[model samples]
Target: MSPSASFSDVVRDRRAVRSFLDKAVPDDVLRAVLDEAQLAPSNSNTQPWIVHIARGTARDRLSEALLRADDEERYSLDFPYDGSAYEGAYARRRQDQAKALLDALGVSRDDEAGRRLAARRNLEFFGAPQVALLCVPGFAGARITADAGMYAQTFLLSLAARGLGGVAQTTIGFYADTVREALGLPDDHKLLFSMSFGYPDKRWTAQTPRTYRASLEESVHFHE
Candidate 1:
């Protein structure tokens, strides 16, 4: 976000930028964003988030390994994620989000191959020049991991405020072993997700549709 952009502007400007340019983000900008995100509130200030930003050669190598692992179905998720758990309106929103994205890319619901190819791009980091691996201790448990979500959002917002963008992907978490090996992180440091970030590819950003959020009326409950 620019100097004139308000907090609201920054919030509204943020989106899951699927495609990014080949250009790498400068080191100073990366540091500045991390600094801002560090201020995010955490449970008891435990700050369980351990972020590893991979750039240049490391980023390239990790992306390659992820693609290979994905092909072999060498899944190694630290946590079980069942999207089927979302029911009613939640499920519909998830479906709508997928449809909107595919529609924007002109991939039909019946185009199984196309959909698969699109999904595979996640492993490629959508051509991003850098990716951040968000992790926590293997035994952090559900509550501590939940605090990491706050950290993740702050990181994402910081990116948007700087005219950068990223997509937080649980898909990358599926290849936890590959990521751990690439970073030489211990098995105890569990992978939660990743955000492939950099300057968004303007061609895709300008045309790709963004997902809608729920209205407060339906999403929140009034106590008063």
Candidate 2:
């Protein structure tokens, strides 16, 4: 960790790490990062996020389950995505991000097989040593999901602060049933997303792509 690291520096250094080294983070470091994430603000102090970390055999089992579910086309999501919602500017942004990622991976836009293989890497956690699944008890409403998003950001930032990296993957949430079954989670623990985290693999050239973000003028508004 650099002693001169500022908050902006940490945030700037963080990215959606697509590959990771096969290394188990020290227990103490993981615990400390989680402790920091626990301080993330929540509405009414509910702090409704439930996190499940998979490592060793557990991680392997979950990965296998997700892969099988994907192969079988068995998707049982707790919250289904509405593809139609991403229209116009939103759709364009999504497409641009996809193209950037595919280019970084050296996969042609028309290469269906290559794209499928790249998508499958999400299930494999990009060779990460550990995967953390975040959830909420009972049916997840928009408010709880928003709170969970906050928790997720704090968790990622915490990892960044410790010189670690993670990717928040909603793709895993599509196989919520498989994940819950593999992790032995109750039905009420609705899976939100998964974070595959560890030391970033510098050898993975695909991690070089930095996603584009809209300017503040395009995304934010002020009222006084």
Candidate 3:
């Protein structure tokens, strides 16, 4: 992060970084960020988030496995996920977000091949140097899931604080089995999500749009 960045600056600047350079994050810096994220609050002080970070050769093999599993139409999701269940503003936002990405990359909606390739990039971690898979034990239910979300946000902010960037990948949970098998994780672990992070490639980062948030009135309410 910039030496002059305030808390609000970090919050405002943090976004899903879709592209990254080929450089690896130094170990000390990575540890400092994670250590800060560890302070995130959890339900009843029980931190249920299990983070598994992959880099170097291991990350490459995991990506290959994910792509193969996707090709075979095989999936073992710990939790269900589909973009279609939402409606109203939520649905509209999702559509707009998709279009923004496609447009930013100069991919036309009519180009099926190009669209597919663009979508496939998620599996490749957008060429990021590292990925973190967040998992919880099988027994963690809905309430703990909320705690996990908080943990993830803290992690993202921590990355931003360190001048790094990351995007949380829900699709990674769709390939939970492949990741678990490839990484030798316990069979009982439930993969909630994953993320790809690194120092962004400025060339590509310049091409993508920042994610926008809803207006305060649309999401917040108070009564006296």
Candidate 4:
């Protein structure tokens, strides 16, 4: 995974890695990745995305708070997330993706307890050493959030280029208020999502789930 590798290589190598080794990433390497991600283009050049990285004690506390929120069934989301929105093709895709991961983990759909425990893995940061919480302005519309999304993609690709891997979890956004309070963030810094990143653990077979994308014809629109 050389820095000079082709864009295609990085794109192909990049996947949602659900498991990571306990090894800590070097500060210089992490800084380099963040610097490269900062090059992501933003609307009006207003880089509205703010990222807070948690490690060691901070990471433990944040994870604990999120876990407690989940245990209590309390969610303080800045954005709406409803399973009902996944209709038609979206629903099928969502179901297939979940099945792929659960199958790899040996968790059956009928095993409600197993599924609940598996779902808690997101709060655990998949055993990664570092968790980065991405935030955007609370009042900003979708357009502003789109800029943050681009930044996030760039950040993930940057990590991939460095032979590191991560998984972005929107579930972290469910406990937005808890996250903000734990991180001591201002009210305006709304949580968009969070990511757990580090050296991937090859021993975890669940990290290599079989997944696919729709064909270009089905996903793209062509115009003369």
TM-score of every prediction relative to native:
0.96, 0.96, 0.96, 0.96
Candidate no. 4 TM-score = 0.96
Error of 1 at 91 (Å): 0.7
Candidate 4 residue-wise lDDT, 1-224, digit = tens = 33776899999878898888999889999999999989999989999898999999999999999999998988998988898888988899999999998988889999999999999999999999999999998787898899999999999999988889988999999999999888798999989899899998877844556589988888899899
Query: Each candidate: how many clashes?
Result: 1, 0, 1, 0
- Worst 10 contiguous positions by lDDT, candidate 2: 1-10
Per-residue lDDT of model 3, residues 75-107, tens digit only: 999998888898999999999998999999899
Instruction: Write model 2 residue lDDT over 1-224, tens digit each, in one string.
Output: 32246899998888889899989998988998898899999989899999999999999999999999999999988987876789888999999999999988889999999999999999999999999999998866999899999999999998988888999999999999999899899999999889999999876734577888889998999999
Local distance difference test values of all predictions, in order: 0.89, 0.91, 0.90, 0.90
Misplaced by over 4 Å in model 4 are 205-207
Better of 2 and 4 by lDDT: 2
> Which candidate gets the maximum lDDT versus the true structure?
2
Worst 10 residues of 3 by lDDT: 1-10
| TM-score, cand. 2 vs. native | 0.96
- Evaluate residue 212 in candidate 3 and report its C-alpha lDDT on the 0 to 100 scale: 85
- Per-residue lDDT of 87 in model 2: 88
Model 1 accuracy (lDDT, Cα): 0.89
